[model samples]
Target chain A: MQEILQYLFSGITNGAIYAVIAIGFSMLYNSTELINFAHGEFVMLGSLCMVTFFGSMHLPLVPAIILTITCVALAGLVFERLAIRSVKHPEPIVLIIITVGASIFLRGIGMIIWGKDAYSIPSFSSHPPLDIAGAKLLSQSIWIIAIFLVAAVGLQLFYKKTLTGKAMEANAISKRAAWIVGIPSKLMVMMAFGLSTAMGGLAGVIIAPITMSSYDMGTMLGLKGFCAAMLGGLGSLWGALIGGFLLGILEALGVGFVSSGLKDATAFLLLLFILYVRPGGIISSADVNRF
Target chain B: MLLVKRYRSMMMILSVLAIACLLVASPAISASGKKPYKIGGIFAVTGPASFLGDPEKKSMEMVVDQINAKGGIDGHMLEAVIYDTEGDPSKAVMGVSKLINKDNVIAIIGPSRTPTTLAVMPMIQKAKIPFISCAAGNKIVQPIDPWVFKTAQSDILAVAAIYENLKSKNIKKIGIISVNNAFGESGKEQLLSQAPAFGLAVSKSETYGAKDTDMTAQLTKIRQDNPEAIVCWGTNPGPAVLAKNIQQLGLDIPLYQSHGVASPKFIELAGSAAEGIMLPTGKILVAALLPDSDPQKEVLNAYTSEYEKKYKSSVSGFGGYAYDAVKILAAALKNSNGDKEKIREALENTNGYVGVSGIFNFSKTDHNGLSPEAFVMVKIQDSTWKLLQ
Candidate 1:
């Protein structure tokens, strides 16, 4: 009834955020074949940057959003150049380890800059909640869902229609082949990091009003986003969307019908069960090149 | 042979001068006629609980400095040896052991949070050093260890304050949601145990992780039960999130927060959603609003003004715990002359000393020395605390 619908709305709101983070994960994984562990820190920086821009600086919403995304995207590029590219050995495990170190470094920097207090910004619009069948939906939740849709559609079109996007896709399929095809694989990797971090930043900005933002907020969000990416079969774009929503819905339902205390355990247990059964993911078969 | 003898004689002079310098620099022999009384402080000054420990550390140092400036406690100037616990139990234990065995402090105060305090309790008892904890858990003093005392109002008192307010409002069948941590767990225990006494029934009990981002689902579930009021217990961010989630979900019933959120930081984090949210807290938040005839009015005004002037920040009740703890220790030191056993005995016999948190009355069986009256109910109005009448 109304309660179920309410849980669904709540799930979708969180699901959209997880979906954005998962796509960020998938982007870097595709181009570099390296999971960017610091991707979540990009999200943290994004949210905090928005707090500084929109909350403290008192800039209008759209400009603040653009500045936040550009700032995080630049940070992503610098991180790639400094941490990822400076590695002596280009081994995947070594690069992943570097990203892990980068994440800790970024988190420490974030703490120093922002301190440990949690801060919130005003929502995109100051409208009242929309009542649908007795379940309340904030205007910000609608904006989040719309933003997710736009990002998904925009990314799909970019990959299908643009030369750079296709080059990045080709690089994901095979680095040697992409190089042979004159894709400039190194540039593609750098572009992937920038694009993914921008997306993560956007997610952080939108969700800040809801979740509030702090130095350590990125760790859990990043972990959950990684879970969503894996559940969506890693590199599958649409699959990430579905996986994020599914995880969110499952968590909400678990908290609603089952014990609330075991909410995280429930989502993770389902994740383990799915990974064991499918070995790939729910939508793994749809994306042949991902494997 | 003559040149070597001259160099050796100069080296001997230099060695004697260095030894004299070392002796002059050593703390054992001070310029003061009497030996300084060394008091140990353990606080989580640089970690997640820094909000509590930072202020506690500052206030304790401020008290010590003020005491030393006025000559000394019976000609023995107070020296504070403080260590950062980083909110970790192992670190706290390490700090306390060093404070006891290495520094040989006659008395110790604080290890900030409940878990750290509990971790180091047995060791303090074994060492037989006078300890005053700043954590609010009832278990710290419930068993009444002769060596351990605390200044923070126990969770039982805060719970009683909440239930008393609920009783006055004729509210029954309240839902309880608490963060799943030591502070929340202790508050939840008191809320459940004392509900029956207040003729209140806890319709639903739920818990959320400390770092949870959203709590809409939990509130939705609570809404199904339709409790008269909801009590959410946790420190900042989680309770702030819960407040925002409750607003988003439009669960319009009365919402009560724990004393954990009794800070301006909570108001800023919760934003407009903080309106009308009530909690039991120390009188420091509403010291300006207290009537003149109140017992704690003068002390609260002095401590708040002094702390705010010194620290350049609004005074928090968490710091008041340390302020009261140091004042209580100084009272004991006055009676004992820095004797450890005498300090312990003196602390156990403290009577009617007005301080920031409350009037103190300690006994052998009751080491905490404050009642439920230590807490007052306050509501958030317009992003500020409004003392509840």
Candidate 2:
């Protein structure tokens, strides 16, 4: 039972990261209707940027994280204005291809910059194990869960209460209507890009301390995030949270009960089964566009 | 004046044509006189497994530089034509074909992963070029091909070493966790087949996918079995995740990992949990932990110093094995005086060639340069490896 709890805790920790990254994916897709395949590369860049700034440059952790997120967020904005804006007038398939091409291009650039070596950011907390109900929990895991929850709540509040946030949501619903109402739809779209990239950067900052940062680290994480977003209904923020956490827990349970080698396949299999049953996602259709 | 101008233009055109002809003929004439001895290197270089290939390529470059510095091999400069296999077997075969048919290399040196090496083996045999794999799968050299050799010790040898180390601790029940790749599958087979011989019982076995980040579920099942030790066989991120999960579960049992987890990145990723983990690897690593006067001491010291200076990072077992591969190949080439058949014979006849890893004794039957005697159990202590008694 204690062992199960440990697995549950670690699963939640990992799931929290997936949830955060999925939220980022949903936010961009919601506002811009663009599937940012390169979103995971933003996370990779964030982590690599932090490693370079902190691990190599010996900068203070706070400053390094701030610089990483800011740089990555700016990169997202640039990517939007430069690469994505050009394709906005094109078909959705063309936009998808552009994003994927951008993903590959960014990955190549990351390899050149980071030299294809794995790097780790030192943990924010002590490296000691914490005893909880006869199971050991890493201090970093606690930080991961706490940060994810805080970010989720903060985002919920921002969307529900803030004026700028409402304007962004209005833009997502219909850009023409938002523009007619003087919401500065273009700026709102760029803002959404910045917000999503920042969230991905934060996930990178937190997860890099545990999973060493590599140029290709984004590939799997990106796929999992995409699966999570789809599972939750791509535009539903709360659904993304639920979907991400559920997927993580199911993967943990699958690896425990089923073959460990099939853990990844199990998640995809579940996604397929869910899609087959609902034809949409785990979330209700009425709430599909509730970003 | 017009005739003179025509003459000048014709002279210019003729000079340009003469230069182009010389440029085309120069390389052919050079090639016609004496062929450059070509060695093909197929490495990952740009993929998920680039970590392994990056260091291997560096070592290859270092060896080539050292050899060239000494005025070439047997009066002819040795040229290494490299192809990136991208850690895929299909690409590895393509690389082998390119090397054999296009580059016409005398020998091929890798395709680092076991699957890639195995994929390219039939082609290597068909082409009759000596193939030396740097991967650790025991089956890589089995049913020994007359033209194939490997500097990597077999998984059986490493697994036997693991069992021996566990047996010394009187640990009888062991759980196995491995990746589903060829390397991990090979390790699983070796462990299951050899555990009974070592007086150990298999308590449980679990596997995880290559890209899995959370392995807590598998660790949970293995913990339920209450095995004396958990044996993990996988590369980087996977093993690191396993160690983290074990720490999270607060499992105090010893964890015995494969040499794949010997990189410093493992400890860095696992944090404090990496301590007390025992892994069997080539002795070339943790050489400093061995007794100072040991027979392999001098070689290890030299390699450690040179590699540290060259790469600016602490060397791992992969680097050590690569170093040994180059040195062994160089020795064989020197002894054979560049005769391809004689070089193959000399490599087969290599006996008691002491290296940083172990004393290699290659024979016609066994292509692996070392036996089980080559592995030493090392425990991670305070982020550094300490040789186990």
Candidate 3:
């Protein structure tokens, strides 16, 4: 029972990280219908920026975090302005390729600035593990799960309750109609990129202390988050959360119960099975029915 | 007048071409008027394994510089042509092909990781070029690939070193976790195969992905069997993450790491979690702490000081592999006299050559040229290495 609880905690912690990254993917995908393969690099930027601000520059935690998020969001805005806006044809495939190119470019720049060594940031508050029924939970894990919940709930409220959020969703549905309604569709697209990258940055800062940060850290993460997003149903906020958690829990349980060598294989095989059955993903099908 | 006006432009062009030729040829023409011997270096200088390649490249460059400073190897200057493999097998193949065909290097020094070394091995053997790899894999030198040799202590030796340490503590049961990559797979194989001879029982052997973020589940699973100690085999970040995961789980078993995480970067990445972790490593890290009676003390000190002074960073055992490779090649070069086959034969006959890693004694059947004595076990304490007795 304690072992199960421990696996659950591990799964939930990893799930939160994946959810954060998955939301970043879903946000941009919803607004622009573009996958934004470079979304992971934004997370990389966030973590490395925090490493510079908090670790090297010795800024206090809150200020370093804010600075890191702002810097990465600005990078996202600049990336959208430069790479996405300048594309002669904004075909989804073409834009996806451009983001892929942007990821390589950003990674190169990161390498030049930071080199290849992994850098760690101190946790926000250092404390001994909290014992809950004999399962150990790091204080930082609580912070990560809390942030994940906050991002999900907050983004959910923004999309459903606020005018700008609804406007963004409207822009997503029909760009022509939204433009006719004076919704400023271009601004919404740019805002989606900004908001999405800001979330990515948040994930980076929170997780860096645990995972450590390097230039190429985002490559596998971005791929994993994309899988999570696909598993939960792309463009669905709650779906992303459930998908991320499910994937994390499954992976942890898989690692624990099954062979550890097949950990990733287990998660991916489940995803393939789910995709074969549902086609639109676990949550996206519900979303499609509403449309 | 017309002839003079037309000829003036021609004279300018001729002068420019002549200067370019001299500029290109100047380095090739050494002080002794002898051609420089081009040495090809393939290192993963800018990737996940950059820790290994970065230092290897710098050390090779440092060795080349030191050799050239000493009036060349028997009046023939040594020139290093290094290509970054980025830890990719295909990239290594491309780099080695270019080195063999385009660079026309007399001998090659590296392709820093085992997989890259293996990827380029068949080509090296076919090219008949004397290749000295800086990667640690028994396969690189085992079964005697004549043209292929390696400088780093093989995985079997490192495994023997680790097993010796475990035996000292009388740790009978061990859990093994390794990253599922060439380096980790090789170490895992050695760890499993060599266990029986040491009277150790392997309990719960697990593997994690190279880029895995957490190992709690693996550790949690390993905890069920209740091993006396756990051994993790991987390079930085993975092992570092595993350390943090172990700390979070509060599993109190002694954690043993492979030499893959032997650098100070491992400590920095792992933070306080790195405390008390033991690993077998090349002697360079604890060079200053070595006793005067140690045979490798002088050579290790000289290389460490030179490298630290030049690079403005601490020297790693990984870098020492390249340093030894270059030194070994330089020894062979002195007698080879620009002949590739002679270089091969000379490398085969090298004996009692004290290097930063160890005193290498090469032969026809044994190309790795170092014994298990090449490794010394060290423990991390207070964020620094404590040389174990």
Candidate 4:
């Protein structure tokens, strides 16, 4: 029973990370109507930037977080202006390919800057596992869960309360209508890119202390996050959170009960199963059906 | 005047061509008719396995410089042509082809990682060039490709070293958590094959992926079995994370890691969790702990001092593999008259050659040329390795 609990805690903890990544993906897709493939590289950028700023340069954690997220957010803005915006009437497929190119380009730049060694940062509060009823949860796992909730809640508030959020949603609903209504649709799209990239950077800062940081880390995290986003509901923030958790928990449980070697495969397999059953994700099914 | 100008331009072109030929042939001419012997090296000097390849390349270069400084083999300059594999097998294959086809190297050294070295073995054997590998996989030399030899001690020998240490502790049951790759898989094979002979039982076996950050799930599984010791087989970061996870779970059993985590990089990654975790590796890590009477002491100390003095970093075990390979190849070069077949024969018949890894005694059947004695049982103490008695 305790063993099961341990697995459950880890599964949930892992799912939370995937949730954060999925949220980043969901936000960009929500506003742009184009899936940003380079979304994963933002995660890499976040981690590498943190490692450089915090680990190498000896910046304190709080400032490092702000600086890294801000830097990645600015990168996102540049990516929008330079790569995405440069394209005239690009197909969604073309935008995705460009994002992928952006991802690869970022990875190459990261390699040149950081080289290939896996750089690790000490935890924000490095402590031993909190043992409860024989279940050990890493202190970092606790921090991960807490930060994930804060980000999720903060994003929810941003969407529900902020003027910028409503305008972005209005643009997503119909860019022409939003532009005609003086919502500045172009700014909303650029804001979406910046916000989404910052979210990825935040995931990097939170997770790097646990997984260690490397230039190549973004692809897998991005892929899993994409699966979570797809599973939860495309372009639905709440759906992304749910999807990320489900995938994370399932993968952890699969590794624990099933074959350890097939741990990565189990998540993808669950993705295929979920997608087969619910063509439209749990949250977006209503909106998808109406469309 | 036009005819005279044309003849003058033609003479100028001929003289320029003559100078180019002389410049190209200068080394051959200066060596008194003995052309410089070219050696090709392929190391993953800039990728995931840079920890291994960077040191290997640097050490080989240092050895080559020292040898040339003393004057080349029989007065023929030794030229080293190196390529970076970047830990990719395709690059390794390309490197081998380029060396054999374009560089026309008499011999080749390294590919660093086991998979990369294995990927190029068939090609090197088919090309019939003398190739010495620095990887630790037993399969690399077990079938014994005539042209291939490896200087790094094999996984089977590493297992023996571990078992010998376990016997001293009177611990019989063990668990293994290996990363699913060539190095880890090979270590698993050897551990399973050799355990029963040592009166040991593998109680539980689990594996983690290369990119896995957490091994607590595997460690938790191992914890249920409650083995006397747990062996973690992998390279840095993963094994380092495993060490931390083991500590995090507070699993009290002694953790034994493979030689793949021999470098100080592992200690830095694992932090305080690295303390008291034992592993079997080349004596290079604990060279200072070795007595003066040790045969490898002289070579090990010389290498350690020279490398540290040059790189301003302590020498790692990975570098020792290349250092040993170059020295043995240099020895083989001395006896073989620059003939590839004769060099192969000379390397095969190498007897009582003391190297940093071990006293290498190569035979027709044995290509690795080092035994279990090559590995020293070591435990991390206060962020540094201490040799176990």
Candidate 5:
């Protein structure tokens, strides 16, 4: 049905954002063995970066976006080196607490810097709604989906083809082994953190025009991304993709068929159900524990 | 011996003079003139609810500045002490206690959200200090405590306006989407309980949390019900998310929302989808939709211009309510000459006090100043609200 198609397309667009954020979460979890709860704050900082350098200063979109990503990536490096590196050998719970503390600290700093106001980024294109088979889709949605797909494919190729990418994989598997094999494990972990933060920043920039930007915007997105990552089996990149898209479509369908108020609860309930049936997520069990 | 005696006497005199100066400058010794009338403001100044409180704080600051510029009330400068409730209720009770017992404020202005107001109500009643709530929940003013009054219209009045508008449009079936919080629950109760009386049927109901982003699954189910209208009742960001999801799902039916979505940020967040969405609000907002010659025009214009100049942004109904609250408080102060009991009586006896929002007629039974008649339906046109007939 036309309504079904609309929900599907909208779901994909929203799913793309979740997918992008989840990719970062996946990379950080794989390499550092830390959940990086502050990963969401990186996205928020990226959006705030746009507001500061572009929105307030009226810079061109391209340079503004580049500056935002660079700033966010650098912030991730500083966070990892200063806050995360010290707790690398601590209890896993301590690492989680540290990341959560980082998240709160970043949120507080953002509030003080930006104040509490919502801001929007201008859409990249001025095209009218694209109608296909009784379904209407905005040009912005296409941009978001395209950017997400390109980033995913690009990351895949980088990991498969580049020497640095293999080093990160080795580092993720066993840091002591990677160091014995001359992999420079610490640098690989730092690189993984940088790449993940950049991806989050890019997601922030791409979605800013659609959802607008606010200090608290990243918290919900972060939770949804974590859910998507878990649904896909956190260790599998492809699973993250499928899980994110599936979750998005399910939410869209829930809102379309059920009440809007129950949409979130439905998504969470679906997540619980998925976990019950497939404890390793939608992905195969072999891939679940691969990391 | 005579010289030594003279020098010793001079040094003692100097020391006594220095001690005398310190005593005169101390707070305890300077309490001779009329004591400053302290007014406490409990607001959500630092959290998610800061958006509502920041403007109210600015308005109060402006009002206080103007009042003092004209040489304080009854020759005593008004002192406004504030407590940041952080939009939490338990903290609000503590805030009330601190304001009443420690700061000794004669009156308190708010604990902005509904739950916070409800939490602090007991403390206010126990202390018998006049407290005016700035929140829109009708339940805040009910059971009409003699010391409690509200500057904003109630949720019941807002729902009644929407119901009447639905009738005018001949839309009979409506789906309801609300948050799980106190504000949303109260709205849900009002709509479900009062819709039958207005000849509207509840087609479906959905609920979401404050932090939810995706609501498509719920929207899809509601679409299956094929309701004529979707009535969303929640604060900002929630309603905006619903609007985006509704548009994305291609549910083109009329989306009727609570007054909370009247902010420009809602339109910005909802994007082009915000167009044609209908909501009911007080006259202070959507003022341009009213006739130019209306008596309330001057007040609206003055508030709009002054607020824009002061805050560098457009004014919302929340700011208008704060403006009106200050005016009402000033009127009471003028009448009672800073007598707390007499001011409470004057506030309780407030009748026909024309404000930008509506004509406030507070009585012993009703603490909310406005009725359903005070609202007008407005639709978003090009990111701005236009009156809908």
Candidate 6:
């Protein structure tokens, strides 16, 4: 029972991180009809930049983090201008291929900058594990979960209150309609890419203390996050949150109850089961086609 | 129409003649005295395992430069053809083919990580080129492939070393958490097979994937088993994550790592969590700390100093693996004078060649040439390796 509880806690912590990545995927899919496959590289750049600017350059953590996010956001913008915008007309498959190419390009650049070493980010706190009943949770994990919640809520509020966020939503509804209303749909798509990457970067910096940062770190993680996004119905934000946790918990339980080797398999198998049951995601309803 | 047919036939004849001319000139160019004894290197100079490959490349380059400066092998300038495998098996295949077919290398040095070494060894053996590996895996040398030799001690030696220490502590039951890769799988096989011989039992074993970010779930399962110690087998990032997860869980068991994580990069990635984790590794790590009378001390010391001085960076055990491999290859080269068959025979008969790793003694049956004595168990103390008594 204690072991079960322990796995549960760890699962949630990991789920939160995956949720963060999935949310970025969901956000981009929400505003722009295309998914940025380079989303994971944004995460990699965030933590790698922090390791350089914050850890190596010995800057204050706050400014280092800010600059890291700005760098990652700019990287996302570059991907947009160079790869996405250059496509005269893009099908979904074409967009995916372009974004994956951008991902590889970013990874190559990361290799040059970081020299293929796995680097670490020191945790925000050095305290011992907080014992929740019989299960122990790292304070860094708590920070991860808290940060995920804050980001989710903050995004929610921004989408509801801000004009730019509304414009993004308008573009998502119909690009032609948004352009007719003078919303500048193309800029909205670019901003969605930028905002999504910023969120992904934040996730990377926060979780990198636990998972060390490397140049190719984003490939598998991006795959998993994409899984969570697809499971949650790509068009739904809340679906991403629930789907991330679901994938994380199922994977953890698989490790605990079933074979540890089958954790990834178990998660994918569950996705298959869910897809069989509901074409839309767990939180996704029949009418959740809008942003 | 007749003119066009005549022109096409002439072009085809010219192309065939060109190909025949190139093929006819290849052997004469390769056999020349100026065409130095070529050695090809396939290391993961960039990508996930660059920590291992990058160092190996630098060490090989250093060794090559030193050998040439002292005057080339048998007065023939030594030429090295190196290809970056990027830790991929297919890249290793590509590189090895190019070396054998194009570069005309008589010897192949490394494909730094275990899987790449395994992938390319059979090819080298078939080609009858003397292949020396720098990775640790018993399977690399197990079947007695006559053409292949390894510098780094095998995983069998690592398992024995860890079991030796565990026996001293009187620990009977053990747990293992190995990554799901060739290196970890090989380590797990040795640890399980060798445990019973040393009066130990593997109680529970868990595994993680290559890119797993969190190991808490697996570690938690291992913790529940309540074994004497948990042996984590993997390379960087995975094992480092294990250290952090173990620290976070406050698991009180003594952690033992495989030689795979026996480098400063492990400590750097693991951070404070690395404190007190013990592992068996090559003496390159503790060369400075070795007593004067130690057999490996002088060679390790000289190699580390020269490498550190040349590269302007700290030496790693991975680099020492390549350094040892090249030393053995150079010894064989000196004995055979770059004859491929003679080099293979010479490498097979090598005896008491003191390398940075250990004293190598190759024989008809044993290509690995080192034993359990090659490994020195060290513990991470204050974020650096300390020789465990």
| Candidate that scores best on lDDT | 3
Q: What ranges in model 1 sit over 4 Å off?
A: A285-287, B1-35, B335-337
Cα distance off (Å), candidate 3, residue B117:
0.6
TM-score of 6: 0.93
What is the Cα-based lDDT of residue B136 in candidate 6?
Answer: 78
The DockQ values of the predictions, listed in order, are 0.27, 0.31, 0.35, 0.23, 0.19, 0.36
Please give, for residues A164-230, the per-residue lDDT of candidate 6 as tens digits. Answer: 8888888887899999989998799899989999988987888778888999998887888888988
What is the per-candidate TM-score for chain B?
Answer: 0.91, 0.88, 0.91, 0.90, 0.89, 0.90
Please provide, for model 5 over A1-291, each residue's C-alpha lDDT reduced to its tens digit, 9 standing for 90 to 100: 877887787788788888888888888888876788887888888877887777678888779888999989998998777666655356778789878877877886777678787776556676766777866676778998888888888888887788888778878888999999999877888898899999889888877766657788788888888898888878678878988898888878777766455667778899999999998888843755443
Question: Positional deviation of A35 in candidate 6, in angstroms?
Answer: 2.4
lDDT per prediction? 0.87, 0.80, 0.88, 0.84, 0.79, 0.85
After superposition, candidate 4 runs with Cα above 4 Å error: A285-291, B1-34, B335-337
lDDT of 3 by residue, B224-316 (tens): 999999999999889999999898888888999998988889999999999999999888888878899999999998998899899898889
What TM value does chain A in model 1 reach?
A: 0.97
Residue A123 C-alpha lDDT in model 5:
65
Query: In candidate 5, residue B332 scores what lDDT?
Result: 85
Q: Write the per-residue lDDT of candidate 2 for residues B1-389, one digit (tens) a residue.
A: 65665565455447545643432211111131235567777877678887777677666666766776676666655677777777988888888898899888777787778888889988977877777788888788888988888877788888988998888889999999999888789999999999999999998888887766667778878878789999999988788878877876677899999988777778877777788899987777777777876788888888778878988987776766666777777777774655678878888888998886688888988788686778888999988888887
Residue A28, candidate 2: alpha-carbon lDDT: 90
Worst 10 residues of 2 chain B by lDDT: B23-32
Model 4 residue B63 CA deviation (Å) reads 2.4
User: Judged by DockQ, which candidate is best?
Assistant: 6
- Candidate 2: TM of chain A? 0.96
Superposition error at B204 for model 5 (Å): 3.3
RMSD of each: 8.3, 7.8, 6.8, 8.0, 9.7, 7.0
Q: Which pairs of residues clash in candidate 6, taking residues 3 or more apart in a chain or in different chains?
A: none
Comparing 1 with 2 on lDDT, the higher-scoring candidate is 1
Better of 2 and 6 by TM-score: 6
Candidate 2: clashing pairs of residues: A136-B248, A260-B207, A260-B208, A261-B207, A261-B208
- Provide interface RMSD per model, one decimal: 11.7, 10.8, 9.3, 10.9, 13.8, 9.1
Candidate 2 to truth, TM: 0.90
